[model samples]
Target: MRYLTDRKRAEGLGASKAGTEHHWYMNVSGVGLTLLIPFFVFILGTSLGAPYEEVVATLSQPFPAVIVGLTIAAGMLHFRRGAQMMIEDYWGGMTRKVMLWTVICLSYLVIAAGLYAIVRIAI
Candidate 1:
């Protein structure tokens, strides 16, 4: 009396309940990056090829410094999530676990280094 139909089993769900949350995080970060990238490019571009003093002065300003800082933070987070998802889909077992950890570590490293550099210039 316990042979459930395919539809009945399918009604519940699969592995993770947090897929939607992850999806939204990815989408939101993507949108943030979309807006931030142009500003980041503008800030970086202006400083490019300029004298070291000028570039340092430009980044020292509050506005441009904040823009670069936010861009790096958001971009690294977005990269981490996307890479984790990709590695999960393509890898398995220990390999998948190691890859996810490695990517997360690298993302944090980039974020910290970027903020440190920006702060050094801005201050």
Candidate 2:
């Protein structure tokens, strides 16, 4: 007795392929997030109980500033990709396209804001 019907087997798990570019993007983002998370946590942990000026001063260091900026940028990209994937999965038709564009715009805005803040603190 066959478990899957011939038509079901032919469909082949819908249009989404598991081992495609989507998987690659997720894998790369996962690795980047793993590295970025620790740096972000460290920054937050060290900044705790510190005054605003002190926090700014700490970030002003070239090394810390660069690390923080890179992490923030990577994080934004990761978030954008994940959200886009989810939107595509759950939404369809014009709504899906709108949501995708919205995610893209939001991600860009977040990255821009982060970069601006980092520059202000560092410089």
Candidate 3:
């Protein structure tokens, strides 16, 4: 017996089970980045070209530290999802799998490194 509704069947989930989820994630992340980028830019801009100690002091403050951390995490995760969509669209077979894995790893590495640097500064 068939369990799927017409809507579900029409969504064509057999080939890609996460189309809607991926789109939703991308949208959410886009909104998050929109909200975050201005604050992030302002913080970085204020620190730009300052002496090393001043830069450290600025970033060490809780608000700037938290903003930077959140921005890094959100941006990298958004990038990962977008890159996955691109690779899936353009590449095929093992190449697609390899590219996806590479993108995922790179995105996470960037997020980890950014957060680590923020923590180092804040502490």
Question: Which pairs clash (backbone N, Cα, C closer than 3 Å) in model 2?
Answer: none
lDDT of 1: 0.91
In candidate 2, stretches whose alpha carbon ends up further than 4 angstroms from where it belongs are 1-19
| Candidate 1 wrong stretches, greater than 4 Å | 1-13
Question: Candidate 1, clashing residue pairs?
Answer: none
lDDT of 3 at 64: 90
- Model 2 TM-score (2 dp): 0.78
Clashes of each: 0, 0, 0
Candidate 3, residues 52-87, lDDT tens digits: the string is 999999999999999999999999999998899889
| By lDDT: ranked, best first | 3, 1, 2
Candidates in order, TM-scores: namely 0.85, 0.78, 0.87
Compose the digit string of candidate 2's lDDT tens values, residues 81-119: 889888987999999999999999999998999899999
- Models ranked on TM-score: 3, 1, 2
**Tens-digit lDDT string for candidate 1 (1-123):** 769975565543658656766877998999999999998999999899999999999999998999999999999999999999899899999999989889999999999999999999887
* Model 3 ranges off by over 4 Å: 1-14
Best by TM-score: 3
Candidate 3 achieves a global lDDT of 0.91
